[model samples]
Target: MISGPSENPELWAFLESLHRGEILCGTVTAIERFGVFVALDDGPDHPVFRGVGVITIPELSWQRIETAFDVVQVGQHVSAEFLQFDTWNLEARLSLRATQPDPFQAFADRTAAGQELHGRVTKLVPFGVFVQVTDGIEGLVHLRELTSTSVEKPSAVVQAGDEVTVVGTEIDRERRRLILSRRQGPTAH
Candidate 1:
C-alpha cells in the first residue's frame, strides 16, 4: 500500500506490479547508442534510474546508422516508452517507441529557417560523421562544415551530438538531392 505523498508509493506499487513490463511516457536523462536513460512520472522530484538500450548503427534513424555520431545526444529531451522495470534496482528499460512523428520524421519534414538537433556520434570517418535526427532521419556533417567551411577534418570540430545546427544548403546532387551543409559558423582559425 502507498504510505504517503512523501513515499510516492503509487510509483512503488506500479514498479512492484509491472513485474517485467514498462511504464511509458518518461523523460530522457542520458542517451547512448545502446539505449537511453529515462525518468518516469509520478516519482519523487529526483531522477529515476533508467538503463541504456542500444540503437545499434543500423537501428539509428529511419534508414541505417552508418556512424554512432549520427544519432541522438545527451541533455536533449525525448519521449520514450518504459519497456521493462527492474524492481530490485529500480531501473527502467526505455524505448524510443513512444512519440508520434518520432522527432526524426519531424526533422525530415522541416523546411524552415533552421533546426536544433541533439544527436549521438554513430561513427567518425575522415569525410565527416552521421547524426540520427530523431528516430528515422540521419544528417551528414561534411568535413568543411565541421567548423565554418574552413575545416578539413570533421573530427576536429565535433565528435557526435555536439548539438550542431544544420542549415539548408543549396541542392548539390540532383540524383540524390543532396543538401550541402556546414557547422553553425565562425571557426577559431
Candidate 2:
C-alpha cells in the first residue's frame, strides 16, 4: 500500500513532527529486501499502507551486511532518525543507523595501536580483506599486511569467513578507518 498524510488530525501532526527530524521508536512491522516497514508508536497510520515509516537498505545499519535481517528482524523495536517525507511514496523515510551507538567509537576508546584481537574475514577485496572485529565494527587488512611474502592479491592469504588474529596498526577517528595487520604471528583458517 502506498503511504501519505492521512485525514486524521493526529496523524498529520505526527508526520509534521517527523518532518522536523524528531526521532521515534517504532516496532518493525515488515522486512523486505528493499526496506523495513515500521508501525510507529504514537504515529499516525497510513490510510492504505497500515504503517507510516520506512527505512531503506542503506539506512538500516552502519555495517555492511547481506540483508536487513542481519541488523534487525521482524517485530524488533527500533529507534530511528526521521530523515524526511518520502514524497514519492508518501511515507516518512527513516534511518535506523543514525539512532544506534557507533561500535567503532567504543572499540577505539579502549583499544590502542599494536593490540591483538580475533576477527572473521568478511569480504575479500583486490587490495585488502575486510574483517569483522566486532558487531558493527570492521577493519581493513591491507594486502601487504596479509603476508610477509610478496603477494599480488589478498585472496592468496585470506578468504571470507576465515578467522584470524589481527593487530591494530592505525585508527583514524575522524575518518572512522581502522587498519589491521595480520603479519604478527596471526594464523588464518
Candidate 3:
C-alpha cells in the first residue's frame, strides 16, 4: 500500500504496523555521547539516518551512566520497546531499560540497615557524595558521614571515582532514600 518505489517498502510497511509498546531487537550500529543508534532486523533502512531506532541516555538503562558507552557497545544486540515514532527524523524512539527488570527490588531483598557495603563515589554535592552500591542503586553519604573530622565540603574527604565502605543507616523504600554512614571509619580506597 506504500506509494512509490523511491520510498523504502520494507520500512513503510513496518512503520505502518508498528505500535507503542511493541518489542523489537536490533544491533547497536552506533554509540554517540547523547544516544545509541540501532539498526532493527525487521525494518528497512532509514531514509535519512544511519539507524532507524534511537535510545536516548535515560532510555539506555535504569542506572545512572556517565556516557552512552557505559551501557552498550557497537555491534551489541539489544531488545527494546518501541516508545514512539520520531516523525521529524522518521526514526523509531526506543527504550532499552523497559526490557530489563528493576534492580532495586533485588538490592532491597538482600540488603538491610546497618549492613556495610563497598561502592564507588559517583557524584559530589554540597551536602554529600552519591555512591553507587549496585548498578542502578545510589545512596547518599552525607557530609557528616564523610569523615570523623568536621568538614566544610564533601570534596575535602572524597572525590568521584573513589572507593569507600559505608554502613546503611536508613533505607526508606517509599521515599527511595538510602542514607549511608562512615561511622566505622569508611576505608578501602
Candidate 4:
C-alpha cells in the first residue's frame, strides 16, 4: 500500500484540528497553472514543500479567471476557507472565494425573470452563446433564443465581445444558473 500523510503523526494531528469551512490565513508561497500554494499560519511545517496548503484554480475566485495569478500572487497574504485535507499531497485544500461574497448570489438577489439586461457575448459554444451580464455573471442564450429566426450555430448569430440585449428567462439561485434570451420576452411585473 502507498503511504500517505497519515503516516506522519504530526501532520495527521494537525489535519485533525482543521474543520471544513474554517477560515485560514496564509501567505501565498507559489502560483502555478494548476493551483496556488500557501504557507498556512499556525500549521506544522510541511515535510517537502514551503507550504502545507493548496488552493485550486476554481477555488481562487468565483469570477471566471484566465489564470491563478489573476486572483492572487506569490508572497501575498490571504485568508481562505478550509475545504479539506489532501491525503495524497499532504496539503490543506483551501478556497479563497469562500471567504468572499458570491457575486452570482448577489446578482440573483437583484435580478428577476424576464428582466432585460445588456451584456457582451463572452463565448460561443455549439449549443449557445454565453453573455456576460455582469462582472462575474454569465448567462446562456440558447441557439433558438439567439434570435427570432432559426440559427445553425451561436457564431452565426453572435460573436465574442458583441454587445447584445438579452432577457433573463430564469435565475436559478440554488443552482447558480441564469438563462437568457436574445429575443424580446415578457417583462417582469
Best by lDDT: 4
lDDT of 3 by residue, 134-176 (tens): 8779999989878888899998998899988998888887666
TM-score of each: 0.35, 0.73, 0.69, 0.92
Colliding residue pairs in candidate 3: none
Clashes by residue pair, model 4: none
lDDT of 2 at 146: 88
Q: Residue 145 of model 3: what lDDT?
A: 78
lDDT at 133, model 3: 87
Lowest lDDT sum, 10 consecutive residues, model 3, at 1-10
Candidate 2 has a TM-score of 0.73
Q: Global lDDT for candidate 4?
A: 0.88
For candidate 2, the 10 contiguous residues with the lowest summed lDDT are 1-10
RMSD of each: 12.6, 4.1, 5.1, 2.5
Which candidate would rank higher by lDDT, 1 or 3? 3
What ranges in model 1 sit over 4 Å off? 1-62, 65-106, 113-116, 170-189
> Model 3: runs farther than 4 Å from truth?
1-13, 113-123, 144-150, 158-165, 169-177, 183-189
Candidate 2: stretches off by over 4 Å: 1-13, 19-21, 71-77, 183-189
